[model samples]
Target: MPSVLKTQPWNVHRLPAAEGKRFLVTGGNAGIGYFVAEQLAGTGATVVLGSRDAAKAEAAIASIRSRVPGAKVQHLRLDLADLASLKTSVDALGPDRLDAVVYNAGVALDHPPRRETKDGHELMFATNHLGHFALTGWLAPLLVATPGSRIITTGSFAAKSERLDFDDLQNTHDYRPKRTYGRSKLAQMLFSFELDRRLRAAGSTTLSVVVHPGGALDSLTPSRPQVRVRTTGERLRGLPLGLLVQGKEAGAWPAVRAVLDPDVRGGHLWGPRVFGLRGRPGLAPIWDHLADTTTAARLWAASCDLTGVAPTFTPV
Candidate 1:
């Protein structure tokens, strides 16, 4: 690790200007994704909220405009679960070059009988991993055409201890909601690293970086009435938890930094500085499981087979 990466002071409030650049954030209507979009919009870049619901996206856009005053933001109908609609959704992304796409959207089932998407895949796996896998493939042309474009994957700390069961990738046999969700996220992170390797091998300038929000809590998040309304009591109760966890806004820092920081490189994992839980965004060490190239390659093949989309990179 470079000493600069360790010592550089990154002021989350003072973001670099990104005028004329365009970014797409999946599930940008809520949680950390919403904050990611809001922060990027503050950079004077056009921000598109890729979501499945129009009403939620509109509310998020309105909230951003209210805060940033003239923030260029819009909604793009994107349903990650619906792999069939991904190509059409990319088409709707317009003909303009995309500077970055943040894979932040995810579905975590709290209590489940193990749901499946219309595509006949596990719901969590479909939405969190396969969806972005396919979307990246569809967006390859636009991304490859744009100089120095980025694909940022928002992984999870929950995935730290989990490992992908290649035999039961979809959790068809035994599905524990939380464990399965962690595996799905682990799969996504591995894909990002594998994608970076592929991009480098293809001699592409497009970078694929992975980041994870330490621990984000709605109670700790600031109130954005149009999107999220955190009650006074909730804030008071969450104050104690702030010692270890953080608000969604702070949680957005890693991904935001991954997008705007010129120093960020492909195949690196960035996260919170304090115990990988809360604090300023910084370069975090990649987990041992994440470095297993064999596992990543297997996941890539499985993803391509499942989503029917294989991304190919070329130098810009």
Candidate 2:
């Protein structure tokens, strides 16, 4: 191997077939999650898709199979918006070993009239951060048991300017949809990095990585009738998509690299190389504000308290 390879991440061109490995993805029914599952399946890995919609999950599986003949794919119904549903989904997964997990499901856009989930959490907060928090806790044992396993959590550029609103985590008082969404993504990054730190402190082998699929727009994403159904507005938006935003297929590269890149270490955060919004995946910079141990610990404690899911690691 070259000397540089030992110090830097590798660019993925031809992913070595991951035969006998097992991977799971959240929101695998559509968009970037569907693409993530598809690419992993293409590499000979058995994939379990966690989705809320059965029909959509089935369609995604069918779509994967069409491209990769005899792809080993299964669906586990997981509702990221519901804590009970998340618990049920984890129970269905059993205590089996998994090679990796991609926390790909998230609410990327702002919703009108902010609402709370059945768990009484802000809708975006619940689905984007809370659900993943609980799910990871439920599956931590299996993850730690499997040597070299990795966890990749998706984040966003909007998080670059976000600071967690601990006082109003649910945005109950000043409920701005876009700001709430940004905080949620920031929370994911905080959780993932803290998880990595804890894993290392406990001398665990499993790694936690954070990545963002920069600007994955609906107009640029592939049209799959069974999975993604773009409307008239979305079609119209496609006219200018090529000029700015890259396709979702390209967008998924950062995440895929985060999971399978041999050079990635625990706590590593990766994103696009150019403008932090487009081009090939690379190790990008993150705001130093996110590195505050005090804030991270506070968020970690609050997450456990709210979701009732405790991590399996101890502090160093």
TM values, all candidates: 0.98, 0.92
Which residue pairs does candidate 2 place in steric collision?
Answer: none
Residue range 75-97, candidate 2, lDDT tens digits: 99898888877667778887777
lDDT of 1 by residue, 1-316 (tens): 5314544578999999999999999999999999999999999999999999999999999999999988999899999999999999999988998999999999999997999999999999999999999999999999999999999999997898999998899999978999999999999999999999999999999999999999999999999999989999999999999999999999999999999999899998999989999999999988889999999999999999999999998765
**Stretches of candidate 2 exceeding 4 Å from the true structure:** 1-13, 108-111, 229-240, 314-316
Q: Residue 92, candidate 1: how far off, in angstroms?
A: 0.8
- Top candidate on lDDT is 1
